[model samples]
Target: MIEESEKGWLLDNGLVAYALRVGEDGVLEHLHFGGSLGSLAGFSAWPRQAYRSLQIDDRGKPFRHLGTLAQELPFFGRGDFRSPAIAAPGLDELVFESARKIEGGLDLGDLPSARFEGAETLQIRTVSRHMGLEVVLSLTLWPGHPVLARTVTVRNISDRPHLLDRASSLSIDLPQADRHIVHLTGSWAREMHLQRHRIETGRFSFGSCRGTSSAQHPPFIALTDTDTTELHGEVLGGALVYSGNHETVVEKDEFGAVRLQMGLPGGMRWPLAPGEAFIAPQALLLHTDRGLGGMSHGWHDFVRERLLPERREPYRPVYLNTWESAYFEVDEDKVEKLARAAKKLGCEMLVLDDGWFKGRRDDHTSLGDWQADPKRFSRGMGELARRVTAEGLKFGLWFEPEMVSRESDLYREHPDWIIGADRDRPGEGRNQLTLDLSRPEVEAHIESVVASMLREADISYVKWDMNRFVSDLDDAKRAHLYMLALYRIVRKLRKAFPGVVFENCASGGNRFDFGMLCLFDQTWTSDLCDPEGRLDIQSGASHFFPLSALASYIGPSPNHQNGRISSFEARRDVAFFCGSRGFSLSAEELEAHASSVKETAGLYTSTQSLVTKGRFDRLRTGAEIIWQLTSPSGDEVVILYARKRSEPNPPFASVRLRNLEKGSAYRMEGSGELWRAESLMVAGLPMPHTDHRANPPLMKALPTGDMATALLRLRRV
Candidate 1:
C-alpha cells in the first residue's frame, strides 16, 4: 500500500489524471479517474490481493490500515495526510508493484518490471451527487505510441458497505470526432448541431443509417430519452451524449482526441462490502484524416487503400460456393465440376465451403486438420488449386478458426484449451470451445494452420468464420484485454497471409463493426441473402462504408438464412450496386435460369465501375419507399423503387438526383432523349409516374427508362 503524498498525486475534480511511461516509448501511457469506488471491487486488475486488503468508508473513500486486509480504513484526522518517502516512478508502465513505499511500509505484490523508467505522476478527483457524477480528467502526453490507455483503479477508504444504484459514466474526446464518422451498435451519428453551450443529441435509425438523415422522421439519436428495447431487437441500455460546438470543428487540424468512460462500475448494488472495488475497460481508437465528413466517406477511402490494399481495384468476388448446394458429400469431382460451371458462367472465383477435411463428414469433428480430406479430394488441395487456376478462376476456402468440436483431435489432446469456468462445464457453439487467443500456444497453432493451408494450395481468398460469442471470459476480468488478444491473432494471420484475401464472417454479420473491418478486407454483410432482406442490411452498413468495400455477393434466391425467392434482376441490381457481386447457388440452379443468369453477369460487368466504385446519392425514402444510388460522373444512375403494400403510387413521387454538373451537355440513352445537364438537374425524374398512379391497390412503383440508365454528361473544364 502506498500513500497519496508519497505517490506525488492529488485527487480534486470528479476525475483522475496522471502522468507515467506506459511502455517502450516515453509517451504518457494511461490516465484513469471517476466512477464510485465501491464498484471497483468487481474488477480483476493486477496484484489481485493488493486492493482486497484496502478499507473503504460510507463516503466512498479508500484507505489502508495494517498488514492484514480490513473492511475499513483506520481513522486518521479530519483532513489526514499519508505518504511514503521513497516509491516507484512510472508505476503505470507495467503492473502495480510492491516497491519501497516512501518508508518501505507495505507490500503491494509481485509486480512485473516497468517497461520504461521515467518520471510518473498520479491524481484522482471527482464531484458526485445522488443522481450521478460528472468527471473531466487528463493525463500528460507520453508520445510513446499512437494511442494511450489506463487501467481503472478503485480504492475503498471507507468502512461501510454501499450499493451503487447506477453504472459509471465514461467519455472520450473526439477531436476528430467532428469530421470522422462514428458508428456504435449498428447506428451512425453525424454532426448535426454542435453548439457553444450544451451538447445537443441527434438520432439515426438502424435500417436507415446511410445519409445525413435517417428514413424515420423522429430520427435516430445515438442515445435515447429512455432505455431502448428496440435496439437491434436486444434490450440494450445506455445513451451516447456529446458536447462541443460543430462550427469550430477539429479535423486535419488536430493531433489527438480524448476518451472518457462513464458507467456504474459493475455489481453496483453498492452493498459494496467495505474492502471491495470494481473496474471496467475503456476502448478507443485514433485515426488519420481521410473522410472524417461523417458516414465514413473519407474513412472508407483509407480502408480501401491501406487496410485492404492487396487487390488492385476492389475485387468484387464473382464466386461459386458449395455450402447450400453441396453440404457433406463434396468431392474433387464435384468441386471441379462446379469450378468449370462457375468459370463458364464468368464467375471470378470458386470456393469449397465445408466438409473437405479428413474425418469431417459432419460438424462434430476434424476442424484441427486443415489439410484436404483424402476421400473428398484424392489428389490433395494443391492439385485441386492448380486445376481451379487452370480454369481461370480464383480458389477460396472457409475455416472456422476460432472453434473446435469436442470430437476433434485438437480438443481431445488439450481439453483445457477451450475456455470455460471449469473443466466440467460444457463449451458452446456446436459443442465446441473457443480457442483462447491469449494463450501463445493457441495463437501459434492458428498461425501454423494458416501457413500450412496457404502454402499447400494456390488459395487467393479465405472466408474466416467465427460462429459464436464468448460467454465466460475467466482468463481476465477486463473484456478489452481479451479483445486485444483476439485482435493480435487476426494480425498474425494477416501478416502471415498478406496475399490471401480474408473476409470476416461472424455467424453472418452479428459482430459487424468498424473494429473488425479495420483488420479484414471484406465482411459477409449478413446471412440474410434475400434481396429484400439485404436492403436493410446494406442500408445500415452503407451508413459508414464505401460501396466498394461492402461484400455484396449474391447468394441463391431462397437463401439458406432466409427463405425468400427474389428475381435475379433484383438480386443483381442490389449486389452489383455494391462492391463484390457473386453467387452461392449451385450450377444447376443457375443453369435452370440460364438466360437470366447470363444477363445478370453481363450487367455486373457493364456497370462494375459505377456500382462498385461510384459516388453514392440518396434520392428519396420514407415509411414504404426507397430510391437511391448514382455514379460519381453523371454517366449513369441505378435506381430501385418499391412500395410497402400494393398501393397506388401516391401523386408525384419525386427523387432528386445529386452530383450532376448543372451546365454540362447530357442525353438520356434509353429514349435517345437529349436534355441539357441544367434541365435534368432541375427537373429530376418522374420515373414510372404513369403506371404507378393508374390504380390504388394494384399500382406499384417500378424503375423506368431502361434496363440500364446511362446519361452522358460532359465534364466542364
Candidate 2:
C-alpha cells in the first residue's frame, strides 16, 4: 500500500492525478491518490485486476452515446462545473470533461479513508478531487476472494454550503456488441452510442421505460438481453453525466468499456441538509469466465450452490405455471385446466398462481388468505389439489407471502403488520403494503400459510412473488432487516416443505442478484418474454447469475408485458440457455399454436438432460450472432445459435464435447450411422449449420437435419 500527497500539478488533460502501487499478481489490489497536499499513492496496495479502464467518451463529444455507458458506471456524484474537465480516477481514466457548471457544490477537506477491523474486507480507498466536491471510491473485496466491490461516499465538507447529486458513477465492461440500450428510468436519454477498441463509434438509441427513483435521484437503468462478449474485458469503462434537472447518460470509454453515469439533485434537493454526506450502495464481481458460464461457476463455488442447480436425477422434471392464464383469479377449474395441460405435455408439476384466495381479484386485494377460493372452484381447493394429483401432476401454489393487500384480513386486523411510518399512513404500492416480516406475528403468519397450503392441498411447488419494491425509506431498518426476513422465510419454508420448489420473482428480475439465489430454486428472468428481448435478457441476467438456477419460462407471444410475437422455436431456443423450463402461456393460446408449441416443448423435454445437466460452452455472442453448446451425459452434445440479422452466409459454429472419454462412439441423428472418437480425435467433427426456418426437422435415423427431435446418441468406449 502507498500514500500520495493531496496537492498535485495538473496533467496536460486538465486533470490532477497520482499513481498507486500496482499488484504483480494481475489483481490491481490497492490505489493511492492525493489532492496536491502530498503523495497519498502509498496509502495501500490493490489488485490490478480489481480496476479497469471505463472510457465512456468514445468520440470525446459531450453527449454522443451517453446513456449506453451510463448503465455501466455504478456511483456518480454531482458538483459545480463551468466547462469543468473533472476526471475520475478509475478505469484508465474515464473523464466527465467540458460540462457546464451543474447546480451543486462539493468539498473534500474532512474526507478520510475508511478502514474495517478485519483484513478480510480487502478494503481500499479511491479519492477524486474537483473544485467543489471530493469523491471517495472504496472497494471491499470478499475476503480472500478475487471479487472486488465498489462503495462511494461523498461528504459536504466545503465551508460555504452546497448541494450534491444523489447518484454516483460506476464503470465496467460490456462484451456484447450492437445491442440497444434499454434504460429503466422514466426520463429519456438524449444520445447513446457504442465504440469498440480503435474502431469508430456508432449512434446509440435507448428503449423507453420509467425511472426507478424520484426525478432528482439517479434512475436505475435495466439493459436487457445483450451479448456477453461485447460487455466483457475491453468494454469496461464509462462515465455518468447529469444535469441538476433531467437526463443521465452512462457514457462508455472509446474502447467499449462498461461505465455508469447518473444525475444528482442539488443539496437542497436531497433528503438531507448540508455538512451531511450521502453514500451510494453498489457492488461489482469479476469472475474468470463471462456471462452464464462465468456466473454459474463463480456463484456455485463461491456463493450458495444448492438453489436447484442442474440435476440429472429424474426428480428434476419439466413443470408448468398457471400464472399467465389465471393472473390473480384462480380456483379448482382453472387449476385443473393448467394441471391437465401440463400433464399432457409431460410436465411433472402444476403451479397455481395468485387470486386463489378469498376476496382476491386482479392485483388489488387478498394474499393473507392462503385458503383456496371456493367461489372459483365449486368443489373446493382440496378437490383441486386432488384433481391435479389424479391427473398425475404434482400441485403448487403462488403466494406473495411477504406482502399484505390493503383490504385483506391480515392488514385489516393488524395494520402495523406492514412496513411504514404510521398505522394511519400505510406505505401503499401495488395496492399493497410490504409485510413487516421482522415482526414475529408476520413471520408466523407466513409460516402458517406455507404449512396450511402444503398440508391441505398436498402442494409440491411455490412461486413466490414480491411484485413491488420496499418503500418508506424513512424506516431505514427495513433495508437490512427486510433482507434478513426474506432469508428467514425462505429458510423456514425450505425446512417445512423439504421437497417443494420455490421460484423467486421480484416483479421479475429486479431481485435477481447473488443474495437471493441462495434461497430460490429458480428466478423469473424478466417480465419481457418476447423471444428477441429474452435473448438479451438472459444474457444480462447471466452476467452475474448461474444458468442452472435460472428459469426461461416460455410466456405466450405478444407477451403480457411486451406485446411482441415470436415463433415457438425461437422461444424454445431462448429458454434452453438455462435448464429449468416451463410455460407461462394460456392453454387456449397454446392450443392455437399447438403443433409448433408441442414440437418446441418436445425438443426441450427430450434433450433436457443435455440442456440442463450438461457442462456449457459458449460458442459465440461476440458479434451479430449468439450460440452455445452443452453436453448432458458428457457423451452427447447439442448446439444452439441465433443470428441477430441475416448474414451473407450463415457461418458454421464448431463445438467440442467436454469430459468425453477417448475412443467413444457417438451418433449424430441427422448425420446417420455412428462415428468413433478415434476418427474425430484425429480430425475434429464438423457441426452442420442448417436453416431451421419452418419447423425443426426430426432426425430420428441420421445424416440429414439435426431436426426437432435431434438426437445425438453416444456410447462409452
> Model 2 — TM-score against the truth?
0.59
lDDT digits (tens) for residues 366-406 of candidate 1: 77667788877889999999999999999998888767877
Q: What is the lDDT of residue 506 in candidate 1?
A: 60
Write down the lDDT of every candidate, Cα atoms only. 0.46, 0.48
- TM-score, per-candidate, Cα-based: 0.62, 0.59
Q: Native-vs-model 2 lDDT?
A: 0.48
Clashes of each: 67, 115
lDDT winner: 2
Off by over 4 Å in 1: 1-312, 421-423, 474-481, 623-627, 630-636, 648-652, 689-717
Find the candidate with the highest TM-score and give its number: 1
C-alpha RMSD (angstroms) for model 2: 11.9
Clashes of 1: 67
